[model samples]
Structures are given as structure tokens and as C-alpha cells.
Target: MCVWILIGLCIITKVHGYSDGDFPQSCDSLLPEHRRSGVNILPQNTKPPYKVTYKPGNNGEPITVSLESNPGHKFSGFMLEARETQRVDEGPPVGRFISLQPDTRLLTCSLSADSAVSNRYSAGKTLIRVNWTAEGAELDITFRATFVESYAKFWERVDRKVTIQTTTPPPTTQPSTAEPSTAKPSTANPSTVKPSTAKPSTAELSTTNSSPVTTSISSSTTQNTQRPDALGLKREGTVQMSLDILFVGVKMELPNIITITITNSLFSRGLIKVSNILCSLLSMAVEISAPILFCANDSCTVTLIALMCVVIVINFMDLVIVSLPIGPSHELKDICDLAAKVCSVIHMVFTIAALFVAVLEIDDCRNNRKDFWLLKVMTAFTVWICLFLIWTFVVSIHRNEILGRNKTGSSKWREQGKKNKLSAAEVIVTAVSVILIMGTLSFTVTVIAGIFLAKQTCA
Candidate 1:
């Protein structure tokens, strides 16, 4: 039973960690059949079984060729050559002779210049040759090739294909024209045509007299002037559509919005959503951490709750500030922005402290199952809160430039500001932003370390 259990465990480990379930068994799968058929050469096995791996490289990277031999058999040394199959350009043969280390089971080498391979990856193939001495026999492998394509080249091809696909309109069928009417004209029309000598009806006379006035009015139609914001609306629509397409993948959970009304709505709802999530995490953390932390020092729990309340208030303030309209002067906007920046700093400080405290509490949590799980939950919440905080900080930094500023206007004030060294306030804001980012990072690291330490202690 123990033997079978050990065997099962080995099988599970191999399947989960080491086995390549669906990967190609050989280098033959690297290129299309036509490309592989003519170039692939089966290496001679004069001594024992071995495997060869071919890896095509990308820009600024080298092509890797490796050989692995069975135990008690290995290649002593090898010569390799690689050249582009289609010789539109002439260059030095990309080949080298590599000596294997003594008793080494595996030997690998890079062929061709990394720069050259990068430059000629698209529609390029490197014909390779290998010759080696093993088991007192010299064996050679010739003409094996791998297709090469840099990631940049691959994306370029994709873009070209996408452009072509988008631009090519679907096949359209012309509406068939009806055959020309062939019925002859009425027989009596030409000879029996009569000219009426009657006086015109009153309505017809009135319409004729009124027709000139109507015609004059119609001919003198005024063109409606475009609204001042019409062009702005068109540009906004275009930009919004572009963003919607770009973020369609991730928009389900975290949506991107650009329009004024929609952006305001998103922020209002997002603030609530973020606050609820944070509150849930805080409650979980408090519950899990109470035994380890609150029991020893109840002040820490009160401090955490109080910090959470302050954070909630700050978030509420942010939502309010964001919801506010831009007043006649930019002063109100700047003030709101400044408030948000300050709030971010305060939030960062508390968040970092909370994470640190939670992690510290986990030192006592190793023996208690409840304590262990709760600490983990708290750590997770702290990480999430830190992530949201960082995002808020970044958004605050770029909010004015992206969403509030006039794109086309020239600002002498900004030019002068740039000419002058940054003001004390600007310097302070910059310093705080940097500090906030660093604190968030440190807090995240603390949470991760706390989790690691707890796991190690449990183990």
C-alpha cells in the first residue's frame, strides 16, 4: 500500500509539475510541414539515443540549439551552420564549432548574430548543420532548419492582416434594373389631343400667384450655424468609442468611461463599490485578527476601525470632489484636486500601518487555525486596498491633464510656470506622491511577507 501511495504521489507530481501534456513531441511541430519536410534531417544514432531541441529567437535574443544525450553517451563536440533559406541578402555563414564540457550530458549553442536574426526574422529560415563525435564515431546532422519570427514582426503581420480584413468590404450584389417599359403609348393621344379653352380654377390661380413667394422663400433658405460644442461632441464620441473597443475585454469588471456624465456616474458608483469591498475586508481582518491582536492589545483593533472610518470619509470626500462641476475659475478644480492628493497620502499612511500591524499579529497565529485563516484574509484585504489606493494616486496625478484641460489652448501661465522652477507646493505634492507610491509598495511587500512567514511557521 505504501509503495502504491508513493507511486501515485510521484505520478501526481510529474503530471502537475514536470509533464508537458500537449506540447509538441519534436521540433517538427515548430514550422509548417512544407517548410519542415525539405529541411529536417534525422540525426544519426551511431551510439545511443539523444534529443535535439530547436528554439527560434526574437529581436535582441539569440537562437538556442541544445542536444541531450542518454546516460553514458554524449557528443564530444559539434560544428553548427545556419543560413537563410531564401538568399535575397548575402551575409557570413552563421555557424560555430562548440566543444562540450567533459562528461556533460547536454550541450547547447547559439548560432547566427542576434541582431542579424532579429533583422531577418520575417520570411526567414535558418538552415542548420550539426556534426559531433560520440562513442568513437563521428556523426553529422545536416540541413535541419527552424522558421524565425520576432514578436514585433509577428504583431506587424497581425496588424496588417487586421487592417486588410477591416478595410475589405463584403461582396455586394447590384439591384437588378427592371426591363424598360415596352407597352406602346395610348393610340388616341396624338390625334385627339385637345387644348382646353376654359379659365383656370381659383385654387390653381391662387397657388400660381403664391408659388413665386414660396419659391423665393425656399430658394432663400438659411443655413443653421453649428453649435460651439458640436465639434467637441464629435471628437468626444470618437474617443469614447475607441476606448470602449480598447477596453472591451476587461470592461465587465473595471470599465473605462470618458464622457462627462458617464465618468461622473462611474466614479459615484465606483466609490460605493470600493468602499463596500474595503469595509468587508476590514471586517474580515478584524474578525480574524481579534484573537491574535485585540486580545493582547485591544487598542490596535480600535485604531484599525478608526483608520477605516477615516478612509471611508476620505473616499466620500473624493467622490464629492469628483462629482463637483468645474467652476468659472480653475481654483475650485485645483482645490478639489489638492484635497484628493492629501486624502491619498493620509490613506496610504494608515493602509501601510494597518498592513504592517496585521502582518505583525500573524506571528502569534501559527498555532491557531482560526487565527491563521483570518490573518490571511486580512492580508489579502490590505493588498487589495493598497492596490486601489495606488490607482487613486495615479488617477489624481493625471486627472487634470487628461480630463479637465483644454487640449488646443495655449497657456502662458503654464509656460511661465515651467520656466520658473517648481513652486514649494508643487515640490511638496511631488514628494508626497512619490512617498505614497513607495508606502503602497512597502505595504504590499509586508502583506506578502506576513503571509509567507505564517506559512513557514505553520510548516
Candidate 2:
């Protein structure tokens, strides 16, 4: 136990500690001083996986600068700096960080103290905000950051421009100078106030009831001047949303995609729904449909049997048709191999147990015993557990397939996953998956609803 504790401590320290002490050593170039072996990595040429946003700030006041990464995209280290927009390329870091978030620290990238900000440790981060004080005439500046996902993956020069909102002293609320009520009669004759030389415009010249035309024209002008062209705004919003989705897909780290996909597919939805359905759906029968047997319902036994049967068939087909030769246990030769072995054995046990329960369930429903409730509960949980393992098994196979590629870069995977057309097998499997999920969900809901209505009474 002591040894294990020590090892755990070591891992935490290694992962969270900042070995390269905070300094402006590489502030000029913003390149991480990493090992020469270098993993052949380069700055991402694609849409950045990060976003930099800031509310407008008055000069001399601290602006809350926020750096946020998209869902599932996290970084381990980062350096943030601001530069005068006009001299962005040549200028030193401009703003001073007055305050900072935890896990971040100020750096003297320029001669000034706290001229830049950076991560204090190497731990993963999804979002960070810092209070940077904008000073001087260079209120219009650009923010740039270098995000390090890992030693091998980082993007430098992620940039955003902001013009600090400054208060112009409210335009010096001027005193209104009242004009004389009567203009001293101009020192000229009354005849001198002749008709103006300027000719009337075409509409003004038409004195014969032109008010309607003037009103219509003025209304149209007003409509055009007002904000929010509905169609234009909608179109812009839709395009931005589309691009955001596309960029999100393209920016995913390839190394994490398999694990993230498997986890989300299995637990995020499947596990939650499966457990909830099984635990609650059976109660309907107990409350109403059971006629006394929420525990006695035959659906649990039947569903369990069907699920186990499907799993068994899937295992057999995978071995014979999909994996072939030595089966998936040897074919994939990764975590999938272990999953193949474990899932098959667990499902086999479940099938036998389910069949055994089904017999007792039928007999009990006929004779009406308290043990019937126990049997129903057992069946529900068993089926749920089996589904969990089944999803794991499914995900492992898919994960192995995705990770088995001989590729090196994330870009290649993004291009392939995005631009590639679906194959016939892929299309078919996708359709089957959709159908299966819908059918099972519907089945769960129906079982729950069944409890609401008592068994049909004989007329």
C-alpha cells in the first residue's frame, strides 16, 4: 500500500508539476522548448481548437480576458500575451495582468512586470480567464496564445483582436446656449427677404398631395436604417453555426477520439438510459400492471432472453465472419482482444441465467409466489448489466478499428472521417444500430406504461 501510494504521488507530481519553471525564455518565438526528437508536430493550420473572448474594457480598467477551448478539446499548458494591433508582429507583450485565475501566473515577457500570462502547471485545462489591464495609447491590441495539448501537440499564434472600449468623458455635456427669441430684425429691408434661390426638389415641387409618397419613402428608409435584417442575420448565424460544428469535428485530437467516442457512446447515453429504464420500468408493473407482479412480469425474462440471444449470435458471427481465422481475440490483438474474451464469457453466463429465470418466471406467474418479484428484479438488473458489457464490447471493437490505422497526424484522420463517403457495410451497420436503439427504447417505455393499466378483466 505504501508503495502504491508513493507511485500515485509520483504520477500526480509528474503530470501536474511545472518542470520548466515560469520564465520568458521562449517568449519571443512562442515555441515550446521541447526535446529534439520532436514527434514531427507543427502548428495546426486548421481552424483553432480554442476561442479567445473579452468584454470591451475602458482604458486603465482591467479587462476580463477569457480563453476557452471547445468541448473535449483540452490543453496542458499555454502562454497568453497581448500586443498593440498596429505593431502586433514587432511589439512586445503590452498588457499587464492585474489578477489571474488559479493554475495561471504572470510573466515578464517584456521589460515590464507581469507583461504576460501563462499556465502555472502542466495540468489539463478547458478554459481560463485572466484580468489584463490595458494601458497607454495602444488600447487597440491583439491577443495571441500558444496552446499545448501535449509535448507533441500544440498550436501557436491563436489570435484575436479587440478594441478597448474607452469612456470619452460623456462628450463634456455642453451648456445649451439659448438663441434670442426674436432675431434683431436684420438690418435690411422687408423686400430683401425674397424667395430663396435654391430650386425645390422634384417631390417638393409637386404640391398636389405628395404626403403619401413622402411617408412611404420615409418609412422605407427607416426600415433600412434599423438594426437586424432578419434574413441576413439568420443566414450569417446559420453559416457561423455550421462552421463552428465543422471546426469542432476537424479539431478533435486523433489520439483521444477513440477513447472519447467509446466513453460517450457507452456511458454518456447508453449506460444512463439502460440503468434508468431497467430500474424504473419494472416498477410500473409493481404499481399497476403487475395485477400484483411488477416483479412477476414476463417481459423482463423475455427481453433478457432476446438480448442474450442477440449477444450470443453477435459473438458467433464476429468470430466466424468478421474476425475469421483466429477470431477477434487474436485479430485485433489489443484491448479489443481482452474485451472479446471477457464479453463472450459474461454473455454466455447471462444467457444461461436468463433462461433459468424465464422458466421460474412462467411457473410463478401461474402459481403466484412472492419469489416471482425477486426473479423479475434479478432479470431486470441482469439484462442491464449485460447491455453495459455488450456496449463495452461493441465500442472496443470499433475503437480498435479506428486506432489501428497506421496514420501519424490528426489532420489525416479528420480529413478521412469528414470527407470520406460511407461504405455499404458502414451504411448498413449504421441503419441497424439506429433501428436497434429505437426498438429497445420503445420496448422499455411500453413496459413502463403497461403498469398503468390493470390486466384485462374478463367480461
Candidate 3:
């Protein structure tokens, strides 16, 4: 037991010694030489002339200066001196350095601990130079002096008031004069004048001459006074007339004339005559077809009766041209030629139908409830048919790849067989085509509905 107890004590002592050795004590300290080394330390609280105070002056104000240190540092003793160099010595003199011995027990120093030393520096006109040595450090440091303008001078200039005087000219004075004497009549004039001629009296002659002169002067003055105002009125009238013409033209072009008129009145400021003429032509076109063509009870009836008879005749002529045979070819080439003919016919039919509808809609028949619904449906069908035609075009261009053929068909019978086999790949193609068609159809229908709703609301 004595041996075990002795071994345990020895182990405990060794552990404690190791722990104590690992623990930290004092921080790293700088030597006196290191502290005394000169460094370019920037002043914390000293923005040079170190301090500033302003008092009134004849032109402006004078600024005063004080020198001080940053907080947490002692003032120690300081030298006030200008910077000296080999070429120039233009700074203040060196003075006895004052010591700032801070007493920890003093309340003033304690309160001032948080305040900057510059706050205690007196404000005066003298330029301040500062050199400070820290309490324990032997090296000397210096800062150049400067002066800052006061806020009062800045504000005074910014808010300065000015006065101006204007003199009025004195009223003019009119001269008073006596009336002129009347002239004596010439004695020989009445007798010497021809006996057959009648002699006019002086009063009559004077009145006749004066009347024309007075009238001419009055007319000239009136024209001069009214010319500017008359010109202004004429300009205004011309502008208004132009605006009226523009409005008329727009009404002619658009189907919804009333809505257009209201919109123009609300948004447009002036008239444009060219716009009016164009709109009028468009309106006439729309009005002509509305009742007879677009709103007709039967498509065949409108097709026969409408002015687009010329277009119909041309399309018929094209059909005839396509049907006529030009040359013989292989089976695949024959099928391609046949497809081209069918595509051309389809395109012609679609174009004729579109033109017919457009002409009828322009005439104003689009406003009819039945006609409008028919048109909407026709438009939707047309869009779908266009998509189908595009797909057909793509399939035609890549017929071999789509039909899983290694090369083009050599004969008409082989071409027919390949086209027939297309039905076999329908499941995949149809699914993708349907998805694309449905997405496009939904988007188109939504847009058309929105347009219709906006038109209705605007109307």
C-alpha cells in the first residue's frame, strides 16, 4: 500500500506540471528601441491648423487655430515649428514642449478619455505646428499646420441677398399754339375761268379733298391693326380642317368607325388629311361587300354575285392549266407530280376562300351574328389546314426517310406502296402531331377570343 500511494502521487505531480507548462501568461512586449523608432503616424484628431474658430471680418471672417492630440495618448511635451529643408525653412518656431500628465484618479481626465484632445485646443488666428513625444518614447514627431474656412462663411455666400432698382421715364409735355389765319381768295380766278365751266366754292373743294384723305388713312390703320389676328385665325382654321380630314379617312378604313372616332378624339391631337383619304377608301371597300358578300346566306350565292368574280375566273383558269398533262415520268416522279398538283389546287382554293371572306368582312357584313360565327370557325379551320399543309410539305421533302425507304421509288406502283405504308407509322406521328396541333390551336383560339373581347369593350 505504501508503494502504490507513492507511485500515484508521483503521477499526479507530473500531469500538473505538464498542464501548467502549456498555459499562456504575458503578451509579447516591444523593446525601448522598437518603441523609439520614427514612424509616419497620421494624426487621428488633428485636421490642420489643428483647430478652427471664426469671427467677423470686413470682407469675410478670420479663422483661429489650436494644436492637440488624439484621445488615449498623452500630450507629453510638444514643439511648435515649421518644416525645414535644404532649400526652404517656412514653418513656426520651436517652443518648450508641454507635458500632459494624465491622472487616473481625476474626474476631468476620466470624462475626457472618450473626447478628442483637439476639442480642448483654443481657437485663434495663429497657424499651429505640432510635435509630440509619447510619455516613455524618446523619438520626436511633427505635423504640418493648416486652416479650414468656417461654415458661417459658406452659408453667408450661399444665402446672400441682392436688390435691383429700375427708373421710369417722366411723362411727355404737349405744346400749346394759336390757330392759323385763313388765306384770302384770288380775285382773278373766278372771272378768268371759262364761262361754260362752273366754279366750285372753297368750302366744297376743301371738304371733297379732305374726305378721301381721311378715309384712306383710317382704312390703312384698320388693316394694320387686324392683319396679325386674321393670320392667326387662318392658321388655326387650316389645322382644324386637316384634322377633320384625317378623322374622316380613319373612319373609312376601319370597320369599327365609332370606336375609332372615340379613340382618335381621346388620343390624337391634330388632323392629318392623307390619313383621312386612305381611311375613307378603306371604309368604302368594307361597306360595299358587307351586305352582299360576307353576310350572304350561301357561300355559292356570294361567290356568284360578288365583284371577286374576276378572282374566281382566274383561279378556275389555273385549275385547268394544272390538269393539262405536260410530260411522262417514272412512278415516284408521277406521284410527286400528282401531289404537287393537289397541293397547288389546295393552295388556290384556300387563297380564294380567304380573299372572299376578306372582301365580305370589309363590306360590313362581319357584324352579322351568324356571319361572324361562321368566319371564326372558318378562320380556325384555315389555321389547322395550313399546319397540315406544312406537315405535308415536310413529309414530301423527306419522303424516303419518313417511309423507311432506302431510296426513291422506281415506279408508280412502288411509290403508292410507300405512301400506303405511311399509315403504319401513324401512331407515333399522329400523337406528336396532335399534341402540337392542340397546343397551337389553344393559343390561337385564346388570342382570337381576347381580341374579340377587347373590341367589344372598346366599342
Candidate 4:
């Protein structure tokens, strides 16, 4: 029994070894067939096998050739040559040839192999040669083949159909003409016609008389007209009156009036729209960044709210300014007047609101350093924007004044003032006002630039 048990254990071990065996017999047993064929079953450190595959006879179309390397060897590149001979111009003799060099891992060449084969060789035979080289291989591989028909002949039939269609012309029809009438007209004597001249037709008489009467009326009217033939006026006085009215209308709507109105309207609206959008986005961004810059405290939120209030005022002012119309003549003047009034009201309101917000922010920022810096910047920006608004209003008012004075008397204020001004108080007031306006514009521009830079840096 012990011997039987030991033998059984040994049998189990043998079965396990066979199940997990490394040397697979199925492949190893094919060595004899490989030897009989004289082909290497496994070649080590040998040149990779290069084979060229081509479809011939145009295959009813173009012929494409590709090169494939043996497994475990990468396809580096290939050179393709179409020649009459197979051995590099040594055998048979080459006719027309084309060579291709593809510096790629897999190379392919498609030849329009529709040309007739030379009679010296087969009717539809062409020799394709491919030389391939792979990385880490010493010997280059060469592939050769003679292509023949191996695909459906569709292109030939298509070509024949195209040729027939191109050669054919459309059929045309000949036009038919009407035949002459065969019936003859009846002939009667003058006696049979009897005195059959119908009663005198009023229509014919009226037609005959119409032309002379119309001509007489036209001549009389032409003589009575007093204007030149070119202007078609009844009298010279009427022509002068028409010219006066035309000139007056043109003067009322002068070119400069229309141009300046359009330019100012577009400029103001464009600036307002752009500034509003930017300011709104900036306000939202500041709100979002409040927590990051300052701790989530009461004072920080107050400061942010104060800053946002100032932005709201500025945005409101921009909207009001943009809504004003600057257009043709009277309409533009009316709009300008309305805008000036609305602007003055809004400016006063914004100024008061901004001052209140600035005071609140200053109080809030006393407890937070970050909030203090932010509020300080906000205060400066608000003051700058207010000053700019005021300066713009002053410029608009001044322009209106200049236009009004010019219209009243065709004299400019600058020239007239230079000639007549003599008061020191007036000169001092003018100098101070100009300086203030210029200073305001410069300060506003500088603040705007600084704010833009700060935002960019923070971003």
C-alpha cells in the first residue's frame, strides 16, 4: 500500500509538470517541417525579412506597394524602384523607372500602373523592387515581385463609359414654319360697292385736331413762363425765393453741426458703455476678493460695501451721460440742455453719497489695515471720478457758450476777449478755473491707470 501511495504521488507530480511545461511541444514539433522546407524556424541576429506586396495591372485602379519587416524588428525605411529588371539594372534590362525614399518606419508607394507593359516582356507584368533597412541590423533586405491582375476590373469599364459619354452629342430638333393660306379674297365692281362711305367718324376728326390744339397751348404756356428753361420756374422772383429758402435750410443744418453732434454722441456713448461694463466687472471682482484680502469681519464687509457704493454712483452717472442725445440741430441742443440739467442733479447726489461712504469706510478701516489701504484707494478713485465728471460738464457748458456767442455775433470769445478784457479779477478767475480743470483731468487719468495696474497685479 505504501509503494502504491508513493507511486500515485509521483504520477500526480508528473501531470502537474506537463500542465505547466515551459517548452511547448506544439511549436517544437514543427522543426522537421521547417527543415524540409529549408527555411530557418528561428533566426537570431539575422537580417530582418523584408517582403514587398503589390497589386498589379492597376488592379482596375492604381497599384500600391508596401514593405513589412519580421516581428521583433522595427520597420525603419524603404526604397522603391520600378524597373524592367529585378537585379538593380543588371538582369533583363530596365525600361522606365521611379524611385521613392520614405524616411519612416513603414513605407508605402502607390503607382499608377495603368501604362501598357512592354511587348518584350509579359503583357501585364511589371517588376517592383524594394530595399528595406531596420535598426540594429547589418544586412539590408530586398523584395521583388511581378504584379498581375488580382482585383475587380471596374476602372476600365468606368473609363470606357466616360469616353463614350464625352464623345456623344445631344440631338437637336428642326423648327417648323407656317404654310401660306390657300383661300382667295372676293373681288367686286365699283357699282356693287355703291356709295358705301360710312358716316364721317368723329374719332378720326378728333384725332386729326388734337395735335394742333396741344401745340398751340404748349407754345402759349411756354411764352408766359418767366423762369429759365433749366430751372423751370414761372418767374425770376420765384427762383430767388426758392434759393433763399434752400440756403436758409442748409445754413440751419450746417455740416459742422451734424458732424460735431454725431461725433460727440458716439464718443460719449462709447466711453460710457465701456466704462460701465468695466466698472461693474471690477465691482463684482472686488466683492469676490473681499474675503481674500481682509478677514471675514464686520469692518471688512463695511469697507467693501462702501467701495461698491462709490462704484454704483459712478456707473449711474455714466448711464445718465450716455443716454443724452446729440443729434441734428434743434434736437441736439434740446438734448444737450436736458443732459446738462440731469448731469448736474446726478453729480450733486453722487458727491454727497460718495462723501458719506468715504466717511463710513474711514471709520471701518480704522480697525483693519488691509481695509484701510483698500478704502484709501477707493476714496482717491471716487474723488478723481467726481472731478472728471465736473470737468466734463464744464467743458460741455463752455462749448455751448462758445457756440451761442458765435451765433449771436460772428465773433469768437477768445479773440474778442483778447482784444477787450482788462479786469484782473476776471483774469485770475479764468486762470484758476483752467488750472483746476487741467489738474482734475490729470489726476483722474493717473488714478485710473494706477487702479488698472493694481487690478492686474492682484490678478
Question: Could you say which candidate leads in TM-score?
Answer: 2
Off by over 4 Å in 3: 1-318, 325-372, 406-423, 426-459
Candidate 3 Cα lDDT to native: 0.31
lDDT of 3 by residue, 60-172 (tens): 11111124333432232112221122211232222122212110000111122211111112122222221121223222223222222231110000111111112221221
- Tens digits of per-residue lDDT, candidate 1, 87-201, equal 2123333333221111111112222221111110112222222222221222222323222222211111000000001121222111111112211222335543221111223
* Clash list (residue pairs), candidate 4: none
| TM-score for each predicted model, relative to the true structure | 0.24, 0.34, 0.22, 0.23
- In terms of TM-score, which candidate is stronger, 3 or 4? 4
Ranking by TM-score: 2, 1, 4, 3
Give the Å shift of residue 289 in candidate 3: 17
Off by over 4 Å in 4: 1-325, 328-332, 344-352, 359-404, 407-434, 441-459
Please report how far candidate 2 places residue 233 from its true position, in Å: 45
Model 1, C-alpha of 149: deviation from truth (Å): 75
What would you estimate as the lDDT of candidate 4?
0.32
lDDT of 4 at 15: 61
| lDDT over C-alpha atoms for residue 103 of model 2 | 50
| lDDT (C-alpha, whole model) for all candidates | 0.35, 0.48, 0.31, 0.32
Name model 1 segments beyond 4 Å from true: 1-300, 327-331, 366-446
| Model 2 spans > 4 angstroms off | 1-20, 36-40, 165-169, 172-459
Better of 3 and 4 by lDDT: 4
